[model samples]
Target: MAVLQVLTTSVAVALLWVVVESIRRLFFHPISHIPGPRLAALTWWYEFYYDVVLPGKYIFKIQELHLEYGPILRITPDEIHINDVGFLDTVYTGLRDKYEYPLRALRVPGGVGATADAKLHKLRREALVPFFSKRNVLSLQHLVTEKVNQLSEIVASHAKEESQINLSDLFFAFSNEVRGEISGIMKVQSSGTDGKSDRNPTEKEAVYESVLLNESLPPQERTLTRLEQEGALLALAGTESPSLSLSIIFYHLLANPSILDRLRTQLETVPVDASWTQLEKLPYLMAVIEEGNRLSFGVTARIGRRAYEELIFTPSSYANTPGTGTPNTEKSYKIPARTPLSISTLSAHTAESVFPDPFTFDPERWLGESGRERKRFQMAFTKGSRKCLGIELSNAELCLVIAALVRSFEMTLYETDARDVSFEHDYQIAMPKMGSQGVRATVKFRV
Candidate 1:
């Protein structure tokens, strides 16, 4: 009986502690003044419910909450989400640390992309920046051309056989194999795929010469295991975003025949064998790519940054969107230093104020004088010192591959619709609906 009484008292004390702590988080936390759902402020389970249980819906849910609460919202117990694009530079500027929550989730802590500290990230990134420079990346056009030919041949074979092809899967495969093999990128991307370490000493050294030979990195930072994590990070970046963008681009092209014809007419302005520079010069082609990047949204996840100092944020026109039906009130709020904050690509791309009818595949929005100014709003590749390093290479691939496929073949959608390529779920990269076989098409060699 005495033992039972002791156990009962312990349980009661624990429950009391929980209740008190909940109250403190709800009303007395440092960011208690920030307006958001009380349940979110009180616990992380609110975010986990959306991110895990519902599976990647927290990003969308956070936008909805922003409408009800205003521009600045406490998304989790410790994280803040700002829905205003005007605040993007402020949130992403300077040397800011990444929030470790999402970084840890990526499971590549040693990689530059996954490194959380701003200073450390700079160290790791700077060591390899020269290898990814535009001059160096453009020199890989020869490799890109080879891959494009291989991709074209695969599609051509399908066309000759009158077989239906899943372009989504095709592009995914093309991206993995073609784009992954560029430069010494092959070293980083293909490192552990076969689970063998039989590579020659020269091959092993060449794979990691940049980070491996850098005099700056500590001995601990250059471990084979850590470099493998870097490899994994590079593999994911090279594969996922390009394939997702390509699928979306071609799906939109096939779906809109007028757009396709317009693009084709533009392509005719240059030879079928036009170079990347010539293809990239065509205004319409550039616009289509811009639209593709907008829709693909690169990484749809909210990988927010931690501010180095306190920030004053005032709601802009982009905040409290029309669907929210909230009263327009532009008020400034002070965000504490070291707070985790983000303006996700979804919020930035689909902001009604910025891109009207944002969901539609309208390439015209990226045309003329307005289009040039609009480029500032493109955050599919996040800005700042930690921006994606593969932008130049990705753009080159998109231009070259899209030009070759469109000019070489006619692809009609087969047993596929927008849902196959739509941003239905956020798998860190945009994912379509469940059971999507991807954008399938019946192809014919264009004569």
Candidate 2:
């Protein structure tokens, strides 16, 4: 009876502590004044419900919260989410001392994407920057063009048969082949059956020729495992993002005929074998690419950054301010050190004030000087020091593949609709709705 009584007392004490902690978090914590659901403030289960239970819906939920509360909200007990587009530069730029939040759920140990230490990221990224530089990517244009031509031929063969093709699979395969060649995982002979010379040092070979050749670095940095990890990261990113963008672009283009007509008219002047530089000059094509990037939700996950020092944020627009009145330029808030802050790329991309008619896949919105200025808010590739390393390479691939495909063939959706292309879940990377065949289409060779 004494033992039973003791056990009952312990359980009662534990429940009391839980209640006290919940009350403190809800009403007395440092961020308690910030507007958010009481459950979110009290526990992490609130975020887990959206991120894990509902998959990628948290990004949209966050936007909803911002709409209800303000531009800023306490997303979790220890983290704050900012929905203001004006503050993107402040959060992502290199001018401020910022560190990536210590990766918890997505940590990959030694992988480049999982590297939370800013200094380490710099050192590792420096070795890769040269390989992915604009000059280097431009030089490798022929390699990308080769892959694009191959894809064009494959599509042409399908067009002859009037067979429906899964563009997602084709794009992913094309991206994989290009990435393999670049990383030296797959070697392409200098001369193919078509009598074209395709020679470029693989990323693996480049690293060996550049950094690995140096004997002064630590032994661990020279291991095959390290190089493989880097290559895996490149290959994974290289495959997924471009494929997603291509699928989404094709879905929108086929679904809208007038838009496709305009695009086709613009491409008529260019040769089927146009170079990346040539294709990039077409204003309409560039706009389409930008729009595609914006709509694809490139990285749907929230990117967290840690504050090493206190930072003050001042609202620049009424959308960023609390309530319905005009923004007060002088009103600001200081984020204390060690606090984790994040800005959703989806939220910024879909901001009604920023992108007006945010849900529409209208490429026209990206056309003129006004469009160019508005693109400053586009965060698909993100911004600042930690921006995607393969931006130039990815852009090159996108332009080359998109131009080649559009110029050489006419594509129409094969019994597919908007739902197939719509974002279904946030699996770290955005995924199309479940059971989607991924933008299947019928192709016809263009004269």
Candidate 3:
């Protein structure tokens, strides 16, 4: 009888707590006034259903939620997702600390991308800045060209035999090998795709020197464990986005002969082996790259940030944008200090107001004076203090590889469609649908 009485009391207490907490969340929470589904505001299970159970569908669902609710949505009990390109600067600005809940998903707390505190992220980013600078990436361009040459030779061999190749896998391998070589710029000798290191990397970087000798950094920041974490993040960041973007660019070039012909004509303006710096001058090539990056949606996950100070959002006067953030922007939203906020790449890229007919692979949109206005809304590498560090390296790789492949080969898509390259699942970076044979093609030497 005593055991039964104890069980009854515990059950009663649990129910009471749930009821009280739900009431407080629905009414008494500081952001209870923000508009969204009551279920989303009450529990994180709603997001878990979309992102986890549905396998990274939360970002898409959030866009749907914006149509019913206003521009500012209390996506979670603690987070706000604003779907406006015009409000990009406000959400990802100075002194913005990353939201801890989502950073946990990255599981690389020591890496610069996963650093939460703005000050610490700045410190970590500064240490590695020299290696990724425009000048440094330019110096390393030869290493990239060498890799591209090897890849083209492989393609030539495949073409000679009239065999199809998985360009996605090839591009992915090229990125890995090139990145291993580029690490040499930092004096860190990492083995290429084969994962066989001839010599141990000497301590040349301060972070390596400090961590190896146990001399600097606080305990939490400078452990061998955190060093491994940073390495893992770098390996991923260097490989995935660039490979995906390259595959997307090639797929589009093959599908549209007019685009390929135009780009090839531009390529002819320079030497047969023009450098990336020279290729960068081609307006059409640059525009094609911009369009591909948009479709690839670099870093597809919705990365959220919380500001140290209050932020005010007034939507751009872009009116009546169906299936976008502009549908409900009659009023300004005053977000309190330390609120978790984000302008996801999905929303930013597909904002019909910014990039009309956003789905179409239209390079013309990025061509003239209008293109300059459209540049602010291009968040493929994101914005603010935390923008992608490998931007220069990625650009160099894309320019060189795409130029070499297009100028050299006449390739046709083999059993591939838009679904093969389109963003279907988001595993941090975008993944296409299940059973995706990443961007297959049959190639032959250009006549």
TM-score of each: 0.91, 0.87, 0.91
The lDDT for every candidate, in the order shown, is 0.83, 0.74, 0.82
Q: Which candidate leads the pack in TM-score? A: 1
- Candidate 1 stretches greater than 4 Å from native: 1-6, 177-207, 323-327
Instruction: List candidate 2 stretches off by more than 4 Å.
Output: 1-13, 95-102, 177-211, 214-217, 318-331
lDDT of candidate 2 over 1-447, digit per residue (tens):
999999999999999999999989988887777778888898888888997888667777887787677777898887888877788877777533333443444544455666676777777767767777888888777768778888888998998987889898898898784344334432221222321234454322343334444454466865556766666666777688888888888888888988878988888788877778888888888888898888887777877777566777666672543333455344567787667777877778876667877778988888888798877888887778888877787788888887777777887788788877776687767776778777889888877
Across 37-152, the per-residue lDDT of candidate 3 in tens digits comes to: 99999999999999899888988998888877857789999889987776888788678998889889888888889999999998777767766788777766777899999999
Residue 6 local lDDT, model 2: 98
Ranking by lDDT: 1, 3, 2
- Show the colliding residue pairs in model 3: none
Q: Rank the candidates by TM-score, best first.
A: 1, 3, 2
Q: What is the lDDT of residue 96 in candidate 1?
A: 94
lDDT of 1: 0.83
How high a TM-score does candidate 2 get? 0.87
**Pairs that collide, model 1:** none
Off by over 4 Å in 3: 177-222, 323-327
